[model samples]
Target chain A: MKILEDEKIVGLFFERNEKALRETEASCGALLRKTAKAILESDSDVEECLNDTLLSLWQNIPPAVPKSLRAYACKVIRNLAFKRLEYGLALKRSINSELPLDELEAVLFDLKTENEFSDVEFTLTLDSFLGSLSAESRAVFLKRYFFCDTVPQIAQDLCISESKVNSLLYRARKKLRSVYEKGAEL
Target chain B: MKKYRLSKALGEIDEVYIEEVLKYTEDAAAGKRRGIFGRKRIVTLALAAVFIAAGTTVTFAAACGGLQSISEHFTAYRTDIKGVGDTSSLPVIENAWSIGKTMDGEQDALAGSIKVTSAVCDRYSLYATIEFNAEGIDIPENIPDEELTFDIINAKSGIEGACRPVFVSREGDIFTYIIHFSESSSINGDEIFIEAHNFGRSCTVEIENIGRRLVFNSVEYCRIKFSIPVSDLLILDSVQSLNSEKIDGIIDMDAELSPFGFVVRYDESQVPAWEEAHSELLKQYGWEWFKYSTGTVYSLLSFKMKDGSTLENVHNLIATAESGSDPNSGKDTIHFSFIVPVDISQIESVTYLGAEFRFDAEAYD
Candidate 1:
């Protein structure tokens, strides 16, 4: 939040509270870049997303009067970058044709399976579901999903395991689906 | 250094959407200013135009359609010698096509090979009449061979150019040729003539000197030159699958390669050094096996949920739809699959998915 336009720490960017901007980028920029890079995979796209995040914070700080600067920057950058990726059609131009996900889709969400859950009224609940998880777990989940990093990549980042990363992801997905099903009375 | 890598990571990200949001805010501010005293409408419009233009370039490289071929043959592989002798049953192969290459290092040689071809010009002290292959030739997508392996080396003694394979395929017919006439420090040798099984198809075979005279002693080179006939050179293989319930997958070979004269970790007990080296070489097999496999291993994830879509789906979507490397599995497809549980809650809910995914990978020789 750019609440303090002159708060010495946030005063580096041309005397425009640069510290707040810097802190926002340092803290949230990492997460934001990881997410953008995962989806876009293009160096230019990821960098663009990061740059936009900083500029957005710079422009929005005065009037919006933010509270959590990191959160604000991340939210903005992530949405914008994701739009670029989606409309940009990154998914359509996949490099990993043998990606296990598509295979699972072939079986898991085949016409028959989707037909069963079509009217299941799945509200897609993640708020409490994630709130229950430890911060570390949430980070892993975010890194894995948000950034689409591999288990080893996440393990290297979190200093965990390729196996542990997989375990956590599996449990999280299964639990989330079950909980969502229950919420939807599926 | 890590910070630099991180910066490089963020250098190319986009923020157009963020710019749009700010533009909206700026617009609102400008509108309020204009409302005060019959302000200039042209001024506000110009300001908005400037804001939009500022964020317009949007030089974003969207990972989109880049599938080079329908069926891929990977040459990189990881080999294990202990089990290799037990060719009891083949590894379970799946929707994949793979090839393995290893440098001939048994005699402390670099990654070069010596096959006795018909073009053997023995008079010139040439062991094998070898001709180099062309640059890139179109190879068969569907073949019966399970796990193709090539003993490749940096041109060693008696070889000249890069004896690389140039595959160019049009429609169904394929034209493949191997040419070996260039190298870091070697010369092209006579061709071991071998009649082409398929007409108009010549197997280019060039040989490099056995002992590499690398310019810098510290930078010792490892050369591998394979001298097989055009027919033999074209080892059309697929991951052969055995029908068995024990393993619900296809059986493929794993090959490995290391720096010439590179030491192996486990060369003691019973497995010979060559055996160990052979096994390690299997890790990278033409990138075909890896490309098709679903793994949480290495650059791949075993399971992930993105907007209700599995990580596997997202990855394969990008991999299948686009061209050139997966974000996770830098090589073409899932190089190796490992299962690791990732917290899905951190990502957007099932409907609000991120690019995360998961799947399994199992390969055998």
Candidate 2:
């Protein structure tokens, strides 16, 4: 199927046209598959995840006119991939994903058991912290962690050295740790 | 805390971060052709997400540019900027496209209410669209464009400039004002104070002695003020000037790569033959009679990359050809500001109409 314009594809979905899914697959299938493969190893799970994502889009797009379909679809696929990972892990299955969560885990390791903040507060604090960063530094951090790209991948994409990417993450973590420590003191 | 708990917190950060990441990833995957206009919307959406994620109850409604000035320019290129597209997936020529902040709420004006709907700014210009609602007032058609005026004040830098409406339209109870300011006006600050006023007069054109004239009737003055906190914009401090070979000896084209956009400046008086040939056409096309100093050159120009790729999705092509002697060149000048940002290093040439002005790669230092 030929790739249709985003608005056209959305219109098709609203009109209940099955071609909307085909067009979406035509445009977004490769990216979704790549994102799923980054986290999930099994081909069968990846295929099932893609189907689940499409069903979710069909249900969601009627009420949600997503500004960027790519972002919306990718987020859905990423969430589904994470869910699949969790399911696999519950069965004691070893996963091959070296995701950015591993790196973020190190930064948040010092959160004391008696911290006063909830998850919502932590999320807000993180948003404010990211907002305080310079545009370049923020872009680098998001590329590495939020988008689940490797350090070398981010370095190459931004035309920077791998060491620079490491240093940026170091500074970001240091800043986050400082904020978290302060919150703990409060 | 357990490591798994930390992972959970990271995953729950918010949609704003997700949007930003997706923007970069999508842009990389798309190979960045789509244009800055699309990315600009994503930037706005992300801005709204930031506020919403911060627990603000303020809802974000995308207010695209309603400027005929900008819309007309983009129309020729087969792009409609009035609606959202996959702008976040586009790569910028330079980082000319920066995100803008939304206002906290609508500001009540003397006659009605006014709201600054959207703004896309760089060091060179702050392009803002203001929406005006005059509830009880019955606005008639054919209101003279000269009745309203906009003044912008940079709160932090204390710099101020006046803006003329590039585009203005009324739909029933609403009037949209689209305006811009050049770098000389100092648009670098992150927060701006806007004062929009309407002169107490109603005017119309009258044909007298084979000439058009503006006649005005006195009315009550109406004013509104708005305070907007914007984000940091790109500064074009490293501007480079390129003087191309003289065109037919009458004009020497000089171009500057500014953070706001690409500008091509030339002597307005050099092309008399061009003026004489296109005076009637220019008038019929709604160009100001007095400001028609330069010959009618093609206003719709194209910026080309090194690989012979044309920037087709660019917006805001503002051209000013007024009669003013240039202080440096001592000649009347015509200035063209194409809001499409370009990487000077990557740009191979600028094509205006059919004339190709190629840049010397070796001279770029």
Which candidate wins on TM-score?
A: 2
Model 1, B1-365: lDDT tens per residue? 11111112222222322223233334334433433221111112243235335663211111001012211211111122122222112121211111111111122223222222111111111112222221233334453222112223233323222223323122222222222222111112222232211112222344476543322111112333233322112111112112111111222112111101000011011212223344444345422222223231233221222334333222211111111111121111112110111122222211101221221212122
* Total residue pair clashes for candidate 1: 167
Q: What DockQ results do all the predictions give, each relative to the true complex? A: 0.01, 0.10
lDDT of 2 by residue, A33-61 (tens): 87777778888998999999999999998
lDDT of each: 0.32, 0.55
TM-score of chain B of each: 0.16, 0.46
In candidate 2, position B192 carries an lDDT of 61
Weakest ten-residue segment in model 2 chain B by summed lDDT: B34-43
> In DockQ terms, which candidate is top?
2
Which sections of candidate 2 miss by over 4 Å? A64-67, A113-115, A183-186, B9-16, B25-365
Native contacts matched by each model:
0.00, 0.27
TM-score of chain A of 1: 0.65
